[model samples]
Target: MLNLNGQTHRRLAEAMQQAMLIPEGDELVFVIGRGNESSNLEALETWVKESLDVLEDDLALAVLPLLLNRLGQTINHWSPV
Candidate 1:
């Protein structure tokens, strides 16, 4: 399981956001991330490439808790009983 705490998730997701703001075929040459946020993003990207399926919407997860909440709502609608 990807066990990221709320704060870490938000921070890393912000890193993901900043990276997204860069143009395609270009690299993120500058980033204003805390040390742990930088490390977390590096690790998360590596893990995603190595192990998981990363979606485009995952790049927009500035608030992971909200994503979780939305996912819960989705699940509640989809699951039967």
Candidate 2:
């Protein structure tokens, strides 16, 4: 299982705020997937873009890759296996 502590959560929350995914001053409670299987990065990218398309924030959409990269880094850092 993933073991992200409070600091990691806060860091991701702050990053999401900066990316405008979550509004400033609003609280974000996100849950990472609990499965142990690896996923396809290309599919994940497509999914993220499609999911965020409704928001119509071009700048935020542009930053999605960076945000995803940050998330990958955080997960790699905290993954137990």
Candidate 3:
């Protein structure tokens, strides 16, 4: 199991970023500590949805495990820590 409380968040984010096949100009927002995990994840999801309004693939996420469930079955960029 992954802890959402401490350094795990940072590590998860970094791992995801390193594994992503991102293009230039895409942004990966770190919203982990800005709010509660659920809220922050929702906000990030909303941001992704809004961003998709213009360009669907303009963002990447470096997310912790709790939030990983929110991303569902499409993710292929994660690595175990």
Candidate 4:
């Protein structure tokens, strides 16, 4: 399983919401394959790469960070702190 911080979750939620605003109404689906750790992570990476493959230059701005740990290790690069 994977874990994500509240802020990271919110940011992804917001990004998805905004992405939905695209004029053509193109829907985005996140496919995460369930399996062993490496297998799942690999699938996720592939999905991300595929999703990014279609993003327009200007629209392909930020790829939010994943919070795999709950300790202080997880840092949001955009945060002032």
Candidate 5:
């Protein structure tokens, strides 16, 4: 994992929130293969968690697997930080 400062983390959170606005089943290409140890992954996870706060209780759990699957592809290909 990358060691991000607070500013980097905040930027990532913002980017992720934006990513979540994409339609379901439509790949968030910008986020999908951006690599696991970068700002993008930090943003992706932050946005997902924050967005889940505004959704119906169970929707996040349902969507998380799909999110993780796409993210996993990138993680599998990542080099350690």
Candidate 6:
């Protein structure tokens, strides 16, 4: 897992809340495949970008790279079931 500071954690929480991607008081659970043709990352990027407003420009910029990097690592290590 990526080690995030408190402020970064809060910012991500706020972004997810604003995006309404996760229902209030609930958690998000999903899976992505390790296949080279998988479009999950692209879809996630588009979704996050579309969901953000002008006020979230910095949040998007800050979180996206970290998010993508973590996802890439996860994908790299994923073993097919």
Q: Count the backbone clashes (under 3 Å) in each candidate.
A: 0, 0, 0, 0, 1, 0
Candidate 6 worst ten-residue window by lDDT: 25-34
Worst 10 residues of 4 by lDDT: 22-31
Count: clashes, candidate 6: 0
| TM-score for each model | 0.26, 0.30, 0.26, 0.26, 0.27, 0.30
Better of 2 and 3 by TM-score: 2
Give the whole-model CA lDDT for all candidates, comma-separated: 0.50, 0.47, 0.41, 0.41, 0.56, 0.50
**C-alpha positional error of residue 71 in candidate 5 after TM-score superposition, expressed in Å:** 1.8
Q: Give the TM-score of candidate 4.
A: 0.26
Native-to-model Cα distance after best TM-score fit, residue 48 in candidate 3, in Å:
13
Off by over 4 Å in 6: 1-54, 79-81
**Model 3 poorest ten-residue lDDT run:** 23-32
Candidate 4 lDDT by residue in tens digits, 6-78:
4554455446545655222222222342333243334444444444445534343332323244233645554
Compose the digit string of candidate 1's lDDT tens values, residues 1-81.
445455665565457657766333213222333223235445444444334234534545656888899999999999998
The residue-by-residue lDDT of candidate 6 on 1-81, one tens digit each, is 333454554565557556765444312313312233224433333334334444376767798999999998899889575
Tens digits of per-residue lDDT for model 3, 3-75: 2343444454445444664322323334423343344334344443344445522323334554677565446
Whole-model lDDT, model 3:
0.41
Candidate that scores best on lDDT: 5
| Model 3 clash number | 0
Estimate, for each residue in 1-81, the C-alpha lDDT of model 2 and write its tens digit. Answer: 234454554455455445755443212212222233133222233334434445456657787999999999999999998
Give the CA lDDT, 0 to 100, for residue 30 in model 6. Answer: 33
Give Cα distance to truth, residue 55, candidate 1, Å: 11
